[model samples]
Target: MSPVKPTLKTIAEISGLAVPTVSRALNDAPDIGARTKILVRKIADELGYVPNRAGVRLRTGRTNVISLVLSTEHDMMNHTARLISAIAGEMQGTSFHMNITPYFPSDDPMKPIRYIVETRSADAVIMNQILPEDPRVAYLRERNFPFVTHGRTRWADSHPYFDFDNTAFGRIGVEKLVMRGRRNIVMISPPRNQNYAQNMIDGGTGAARAAGCSMRVMQGTTSDNRNEDIQLGVARHLAEFPETDGIVCSATAVAMAAVATLESLQHRLGEDVDVIAKEAVPFLTLFRPQMLTVHEDVARAGQFLAQAAIQAVRHPEKPPLQGLDVPTG
Candidate 1:
């Protein structure tokens, strides 16, 4: 291996090709011939040609790096990986890259923002798993960096974003349960501070008003509850199942917890009580309660947000974007 890290310029020089052409070939663009790509790869390997993030950003006006910020842990859900992959796949021909940056959800989450600013590691950022009053969103907006959010932030009315219409999802779930002869319904929602959670509550209330059903929205705690934390809420409500009748879970965690709790309660899956929840991706199995899901198709959402950020970064004069809502069943 070469002592120095390789760069696009180094590969270009060694392979006797232009920098852009080398970039295109190394990135696996179909436009480049097999011979040139192979030659570039061989030379890149020989020279340890690692692309310098700073140089690339300076040259192309982009770091070729897209950052996906999460409010919770890095491995919060399966959607994280799926979303990143979707954006990366969509950026196949473009000089863009995508990765996730995990930050603790806090009253002041300036750490992630500071990292992005101080290091300048990202060309554009796609903030995900956000709360209603997200400081990161405010920071990015003030800084004038191109960014898109997977979830809507309450601070901004118009911005590039891709989100599910939670109100519709909540309404549909409640309506469906009421149609199935359910009278009392309970909803497990995100904390009240989340905009989507509020929307879900509104939708559920509307359905309840029309159907004459009782709906209560339970807020989540912020004390580091991974998927396991879902169980505590389920355990609290599981004993009151017959009185509850139907359930509307605001997240996959609630759905998962309900499933486990119901199983423990010896309640028949689809027969005793109907369960519906919001999901960012399709489950590997369509079994039981998971089968009845309000799918957000987060991968598609990621693709949409990625395109929006790329466009906004490239063309600032473009009209401000409204949140694109994915229709759910």
Candidate 2:
């Protein structure tokens, strides 16, 4: 013998409500009173009720799922992990749940988006690593699909997004180095194809020009490269540009690689050369207290993206939400 599976009728019977009212409460219907909804949901949880996806879709034509398409190439050191946790936390106790879909850098970014839209697998999508004129954005827009991006594309004005202000980060980082009397500055940016890369380059170059300092973007490798490759690349760049006294890194891993390379060359950190980097968490100081850093708050971005995604699915007729977090010293 086995225990009976909990259903809507089971919850309704326990809560002293009709089946329809219980269903509406569980679905977070706006007409349902908050107190009644809480009571119904409490009973449902006590019964360990799980909604059948097929039945729910048949009735509402919605899967009540938000798909998060993330890149496997992202920094695994607390960056992507924090984002995923925050998004999941935000979706807790909500009508919707999150479904993560990961893709490698070598794979086409559109594959997951296309599959989700074509199959009606998810009600909305959330993604990052945006290009200036991303095809995924265009495709989703054309189909009138409800989606939100963690980073903005060229057509950002028309979509919902929550992005860190990388341009401001670049400028601020350069200004910090310049204030320390460093004239020859170089930045290790992301790939040129990324939209934020251009923003960072523009800000750094513009700030250097204003300060009358020589600034250049490192060649041959991006912040996404492996640690060993980045260390070797930094060493080569230092050999070519010996005057490089200040280094700005786009990622924490890049900063670590740069520091390792400098250390091998008998350069004292914060004395021989200053290194500034951006991080999602505040552990960089624990690793190297001498390093300079700016916080990017990936956790906040995740929460905002999740909220915007839910809003888009529930109320597409309303205005899209947009947020930009500027760098803080």
Cα lDDT computed for each candidate against the true fold: 0.73, 0.92
What is the TM-score of each predicted model, taking all chains together? 0.80, 0.97
* Candidate 2 per-residue lDDT over residues 201-255, each given as its tens digit: 9989989999999989999989889999999999999999998999999998999
Best by TM-score: 2
Once fitted onto the true fold, the runs of candidate 1 whose alpha carbons sit more than 4 angstroms away are 1-50, 72-77, 105-108, 155-157, 219-224, 238-242, 289-291, 321-323
Q: What does the lDDT read for residue 107 in candidate 2?
A: 95
lDDT of 2: 0.92
Q: Model 1 — which ten-residue stretch has the worst lDDT? A: 218-227
- Model 2: how far residue 288 lies from native, Å: 0.5
Candidate 1 overall lDDT versus native: 0.73
